[model samples]
Target: MPSTNCTTIYKLVQRAEDDDIEDVGNQLFGDGSSTMSVLEKKKRFEELYGVVRPDAIHAHPPNVVKCKGSGSRLPSKVEAAKKAAVKPPRRCGKCHKMVNHDSRNCDKERSKKQK
Candidate 1:
């Protein structure tokens, strides 16, 4: 072995600027010989292919909260509480009745002319 450290190999691949020195096949995957040391293989794989990690593996940062639900993410605690806390029905000042509509829009007065 002629001192093929990761940095040296990486530099060679990166510093190639000539037309004859086109980049290695981006789509190519390398399977270094089983006999090779784990570290050596990883370095060789990186030099021939791309970076240490594939692009797809790191396109998006990992989420802190893992969702085990059916595809859809579970709602946060705050959101769930908001949904669960139902607002009490408003009181109608006109009739002292607790209902949806307020006094201004109260339908309690049977005849409008009576008001």
Candidate 2:
């Protein structure tokens, strides 16, 4: 089975592929700015191509349920739930602090006047 991160990334790539298809559709149909949302575009593409509609990969929520079923050597479901509930990790670009916000997007960096 794929690691959680790998599964998540796969979903993101699939969504991106869908987005690219939608862009092409807009070009072909010349639908002036009334373009379909990603979900709608994906549905249309699946219908036209006779392919399965891919899952919402970007919205890939972790499977805390699996953690629940596994034994103690594997973290308990409660622990998995805690990990899932915790805010996502962020790395700062400048100070490199793995705090709430990363350095690249830090306000301090944004405030710096370029020489």
Candidate 3:
């Protein structure tokens, strides 16, 4: 796409309603003399592409009802998730608590061994 003239590409993008397409025009020619009002952009875009837009023939908003479900979690499922998120503290054999030392480095264990 970059190999083509920026002005030519800008002409194609001018008719595009999509942000991504418009960005291509802005990136190439910039918003300078080559750029124009919406009407001019549309005209140039049509001339360059030989159509209003390439996808104009098959353009339709997607019917996405299936993708978006009735957004809600059951109370039991929610409670299960909460329970899964929490876990009891682990007991350390040497230090007796999960807070500090383990078997090899426990200060209490060291003291007992010294005795």
76-107: candidate 1 lDDT, tens digit per residue: 99998787566677778887877655777776
Q: Estimate each model's TM-score.
A: 0.19, 0.26, 0.21
In candidate 3, which residue ranges exceed 4 Å CA deviation?
Answer: 1-35, 53-61, 64-115
Error of 2 at 70 (Å): 63
Q: Could you give candidate 3's per-residue lDDT for residues 1-115 as a string of tens digits? A: 6667887877777756577767767754467766457766766667666766654476689776775656886579878868756755466786687643466667775687799
Error of 3 at 80 (Å): 13
Instruction: After superposing candidate 2 on the true structure, give the runs of residues whose Cα lies further than 4 Å from its correct spot.
Output: 32-115
Q: What lDDT would each prediction earn against the true structure? A: 0.63, 0.72, 0.67
The residue pairs found clashing in candidate 3 are none
Residue-wise C-alpha lDDT for candidate 2, range 39-89, written one tens digit per residue: 776667676678896556567677655556466477889998798679786
- The alpha-carbon lDDT assigned to residue 3 of candidate 1 equals 66
Top model number, lDDT: 2
lDDT of model number 2: 0.72
Clashing pairs in 1: none
Root-mean-square deviation of every model: 15.7, 25.4, 14.0
